[model samples]
Target: MKIVEKKNFKYVDYLWDEAKAATLEGNEVDLLLYRSNLLGTDLRITNYGGGNTSCRTVEKDPLTGEETGIMWIKGSGGDIGSLTRSGLAGLYVDKLRALKKVYRGIEHEDEMVALFNHCIYDLDSKAPSIDTPLHGLLPFKHIDHLHPDALIAVAAAKDSRKVTREIWGDSMGWVPWQRPGFDLGLQIEKCLAENPGIRGIVLGSHGLFTWGDTAYECYINSLEVIEMASEYIEKKIAGNGGVVFGGEKIKSLEPGKRKSQAAAIAPLLRGLCSSEKRMIGHFTDADRVLQYINSNDLERLAPMGTSCPDHFLRTKIQPLILPLEAGADLSDTTKLLGKLEPAFEQYRAEYREYYESCKHDNSPAIRDSNPVVILWPGVGMFTFAKNKQTARVASEFYVNAINVMRGAEAISEYTSLPRQEAFDIEYWLLEEAKLQRMPKEKPLSRKVALVTGATGGIGKAIADKLVEEGANVVLTDLDAELLKEAEGTYGKDEVSAVVCNVTGAADVEGAFRQACLGFGGVDIIVHSAGLAISKPLEETTEKDWQLLQDVLVKGQFLLAQSGVDIMRKQGLGGDIVSIASKNGLVAGPNNVGYGTAKAAQQHMTRLLAAELGPDKIRVNTVNPDGVIVGSKIWEGAWAEGRARAYGITVEELPAHYAKRNLLHEIIRPEDIANGVYALLGILDKSTGNTINVDGGMANAFVR
Candidate 1:
């Protein structure tokens, strides 16, 4: 075994651990995983899920008692950095190579995907990616196909072949742009055959391919190729007086201002982009993103789109750039917002035209015409998708594109894949099939819900249920510690925590803003925050009355006002469910202050429902009589006061309340949560209505 010395590369990190490799010396698959993880650690090397790695190993054949060559490659939709053993597709090497004999041509290449299952060496291996042939057909023990930003810069340049020769001489080969499939794999094999001594190949407007006899050598070869490209690009950028993308055209807003502005416009932009289907948004004001969007060449270069298939696939063919005057003040959010609708409209129109011009007979129906990447000159970039992680990954890929553009433009004229070729890959039937194979999205998929008092039992139950149903939730409450705990309970990607005193206007507004920034705005609002003070008319003090009114009535009012404003701006009809009490309608004794507030909450739901009908915002109430289990409200003075009024011990309050209802059933927090879910998912058509979860409380029934 050759121990390759780690070179201190200026541009890319050499992260291969010799000690780690030693532990897996006999296991080529483990070595491949080690190499893959090292290469994927840096975005400069590869964006998430944008690269593939493979290693050919000898394993005992299941049928014969003989060793057979098996090739393990990164599975479809797998990210190298986080890949597990199951994420690799394992196939018989001989079986894969035999595919070449049956290959008809590029036009009929998609059929080969279905045939890949026949080549599977491991029954439980993940589905193979389109690039499987590229790895398997190559006559190397280890192979790496990467979309490093620096290498892509060289590959996407106008004179990519010339640049490749200049950078690596005859040691590297170049193949013309061909969509990844059997033919392109054949092209690479021919290129290597012609240049017998070449160490790697650069696919024009695609990416880099490097191979070695061992996994460690393969990893080194890839790093060396990318480092050389990075160094050459860096020197050229310096020679060009540090100016790239034709230099800066607009200055970036201050960091704080950029974030505030991004948060302010995210919901509206998300709504506009979501006209076809709802989209979650991710925002970034990173320096590289700012540099690209602020550049003079942004207008010319951005429209060309990304050359890498992995990039443009995630970012879309091209981003929708907001038109801003060269030196306009970006702090004027009102003015900036005015430009969004027209820009989005124009983008959609152009995208539709692009589709019409480029569609093949079997092309998948036009996907959401909305741009995945949205660029604002001074603020930064916003990327939207079905969920937060995808949105964020799209944003990251665009940043990779920006880096590629910067390097290419500095050294040579950057070029994008031709529109027709881009369309072919974007609408590839194999890609569409993979999409169709995905598990069905949950009913509340893409919906963002803001649940108040989410740390409390009812509130937490609602938040958990919403998440389970595929809605991203923002958990807000006065208890910071509990909010943090709840946030962890639900993963951060699906749940955001914000401490809010709903009665405070600033707190309410700020929480909504955070929700917009975190998950692209609120689609469902649950006013579950409340405290109870069970008191008779004689014992109820002005202080107690005021407190109940402030928390129950005023809190609901503030949350509703803010939620309504955001929902209206979104232009996506929304649901607002208030956790009111049955006492409000039943007119029970020893509940003057609390009952009045609950009545106020119930009526407010109806009023908002009537007012927001045109906007399609539904308002409803869930009235629960006695939710004792896991309820913070029941653990305190309120429970004691209610128990005293009913002439029962505090411990017996649950039985007393349950028996009081007609059906004699106990109401739990989860039951309240179910009611909220019903109003949002099942009873979506019914609004301004109250659903009592109090075991058939006849007195509380709404007329």
Candidate 2:
């Protein structure tokens, strides 16, 4: 509850001075940049994208040297913390206020948006936030509106105005809950005029607003109010045995056991929430989360909505509570599905009823009502979003909200905005319009892929192809350093790299855990890790024979079993494409070690297809031949010896083998990648089947 100056306060003060100096040195609003970052970096003050900061300043026209007052407020799509000058939209102050004189029609959210854009002083600036008018109309040099959880704990309660009075006295003004738009801005303008002495205002069920002549004054006011609210909750909830998670007495599972449990549970939740289309799920069970899910009052409190209104768009009002607890018997997978099916159906029915009751004629179209957060007794919380980044962001915000709600309920009755208010924000036209503007998704958008041996050749090609097609790809390889390098090959936003020796159980297990952590879960697996050895049967050493079998045969065995385990949990059918060599079909001279292992890999594909078919997992193979140019297996002595046997120079061996095929063309790594892409089913269905990328080898062709 205390707001003590940190040891680094002096350094922060120095930065503030520099920000002021930067403002005087020709940079527009550098002080606001420094001020926003100061608030944005502290989660206790505001979570990501949950707060806004603004300033009223004069900008001199470069051409005419005319000075005009402008209102610079946090723009849409900019995080308040780490905000820069460009992150704030600069609108002409006089022109913005002038709109009220001519604005006489029924106010619509979309129309208000257009008016805000039209008032922009600099058309090149970012789009103004929907709350631009609130900041613009306020008669102050600086303004900050933050959705701090401690303050929201007070704002979201039923008797919030009374509670806020108890903590803030008359220093803060009060405004009833109102959606952000033209009318709400006018209400605030009137409220502030009537209570001109108040230093700050708390918007019921919304957020806190503070104004001052300088950034530091408004920032300090925010801190003092937040501290008062924190103290109030602390004193009220003190020693009340608030919410206690039931698992406090349970021993923590070992790391290995914990990872396996997570891998098992993530896909099941992903499957239950998913349909034929894919949705990513991120699972976490921090100690606090486990305790909250196991709390004695969970049944009474867990069904309630978020702690504040800002989260309504990201997390639906209420979460879906699965009947099963965490650490339950996962051995009976089929039995688990049976229970989930009914629970999910009931949740859907309730969502429909809630939406139907509050929907208005002009409300934007309803989104999928499936709960975004799920509370399972043992598994903690599972958050779902269209992509991995969004799911994780929503997950963090919900976790924070849970703690805030618990604190509030422990002290007094916990409540949230009514259903109508929730529906209005959830389907608000301004937010809906943002979604409408998104471009058509790539074919594999929302899907995840894992490609093995991805540092070189066919493995790298497959990973690149998946990412290009809109899938989030996890690249795994035997070389740890190489994997790190490959991680950056694709944009960091969509690709991750992991070092996985396919032959090791721990490595394979770790790889799956990484995929789950990085992108929720995997939908497609490209198994391309292999070893090549060439020698006469009698001359093949035991080491060479063992290495080939370990990587080629045993590796596929491990990956297939693990891949199927995860895909089955997801309930969504999956595709597994293993890269096999033509040598597997047509044995080449002096290649016993490589051919035997590849042949086994090919048959393993068929066997896995048959075993996993019941779970709707498709196992298939892509047979690529004459991919000699990029492959390390065809380099150095191996290339020289193969070329000698073909009676051609090493550089000509590729051409010689390519012409020997019926099609008389070389098979490139991308060609093999294309074959793998086909089995992924973006265009057509082909599974438990083999597609040859071998330039039509007559002898190697499968009937």
Instruction: Tell me, by lDDT, which candidate is best.
Output: 1
Residues 575-685, candidate 2: write the lDDT tens digits.
Answer: 888999888999678888888898898998898888888777888999998889787668776777677656789889888978888989987888888988888845345
lDDT of each: 0.90, 0.77
Residue 489 in model 2: lDDT? 76
Summing lDDT over every window of 10 consecutive residues in candidate 2, give the lowest-scoring window. 6-15
Off by over 4 Å in 1: 1-3, 14-23, 324-338, 536-539
Distance (Å) between predicted and true CA of 1, model 1? 6.8
